[model samples]
Target: MRIRLARPEDSAALLRIYAQYIHSPVTFEYALPTEPEFAARIGRISETYPYLVCEENGGISGYAYAHRQAEREAYQWNAELSVYLDAAAASRGRGTRLYRMLLDILPLQGVRSAYALVTLPNAASERLHASLGFRTMGVQSEAGFKAGAWHDVAWFVKDIAPHDAAPRPLLPVSRLDADVLRRILDTRG
Candidate 1:
């Protein structure tokens, strides 16, 4: 598997993987975004945070990204995390590999806390988050209505790095040094 920064051109392949969850109660999304819309989102988020993909034999197998947790300035150091994998790629340790690189890269961009929300009853997702040190904060009971039923969301949080009194200005992913970024991708532990 190859892990690298996501590009706008990956929108289509990424969308295909994401579509797997759209119809299920695992995700609240009821409709798939248009290709252009997904492309725009990829371009916008990678500007300041890590948006990465794992490719197997030239095909996108899975992807993970961090987006603003909230609009308030105080939440700048915190981000919401999400990941999706191709059906064939599930349970093969690819998600772990993608997340390891993602979590490693975030600290360099000044991320202090990372959050994830898993729709209730997803044992695999919850297990993955737990393996990565994410602690359950709480659960939103029936927080969203989807697929003819209300679903709950379990929130988990992980500290990416030390939260100091004063944080250095966030470094955009584009400005990250190539060698440093390479080391992150090559990290196995």
Candidate 2:
């Protein structure tokens, strides 16, 4: 498996992986985004954060990304993460590997905290987050209504960097040292 930065052109393939979850509680989104919309999302988020894809056997098997947790200036150092894998890729450790790379990259971008929201009863996702050192902060009861029922969301957080009193300004993913970013993407588990 190889991990790399995602590109706008990858929208179709990535969407294929994401579409599988639209009918389930795995994600709160009710519809699959159009290719252009999805590509725009990749472009916008990649401007300041990490958006990555995992390629296995020449096909995209999964993806993961981080975006601002909140728009407030004070929240610049915090980010929310999401990961999705092709059905064929589940249970093979690809999600863990993709998230590991994402977690590793965030600190370099000056992200202090990484948060994730997992819909209730998603044992696999909950286990994945816990194994990565995220603690369950709380649960939002009936956070969203989908698939004809209400589903709760569990909030998980992990400190990716030291919370200094005066933290340095965030370094956009585009500004990270190429050599350093390359090394992170090339790392193997």
Candidate 3:
């Protein structure tokens, strides 16, 4: 199997893997809205980096990607990421491989920190992230309402790089020199 960057053409396969979570009994009962505006969202986020997949036998079996942590300038360099594998593709190491590739790329992209919030206590995911050096940031006690009840969320985090790395500039950001801004904005390049 090989790990590679996801292309715009890969969105359909990415969505397929994502849909499994959206439909799973564990996930759906306390269902959260996914990309309701996929078109607009895809148009924007597909332009970023660390959006990747693991492919084998000529098909994508798993995927991982990062996006803006929030809309605030202070959140730059801190990304929110997700990773998923096709249930049929589990136990074959696709999820671990995909996440490794993403973590390897994130710091190079100036990502100082990365975070994940999981509704269920996924031992595999927790183990995988822990292997990649993430730590238990904290959990939100009974923080989410899914299906018909309350659920807890665990937030895991990793410092991808030293805090000494310069902060990413603000949007409409004059903070970065033109060259620096060019690199961050042109992730796919």
What are the lDDT figures for the candidates, one per model? Answer: 0.89, 0.94, 0.67
Q: Model 2 misses residue 113 by how many Å?
A: 0.6
Worst 10 residues of 1 by lDDT: 180-189
Q: Is candidate 2 or candidate 3 better by TM-score?
A: 2
TM-score (C-alpha, index-matched) for candidate 2: 0.98
At residue 55, give the lDDT of candidate 1: 84
For 1-189, candidate 3 gives per-residue lDDT tens digits of 666556666767776777777744335333433444443454466565456667778988887778888777777778888878988888666766666555556676677788887776677777777887888898888876665667777888988877774665523222225464344434422
Model 1, span 100-165: residue lDDT tens? 887888888898999999999899999999999999999999999998888899999999999899
**lDDT by residue for model 2 (24-127), tens:** 99998999999999999999999999999999898999999999999999999999999999999998999898899889999998999999999999989999
The residue pairs that clash in candidate 2, if any, are: none
Local error of candidate 3 at 166, Å? 4.1
The number of the candidate with the highest lDDT is: 2
lDDT at 60, model 1: 94
- What candidate 1 gets wrong by more than 4 Å, as runs, is none
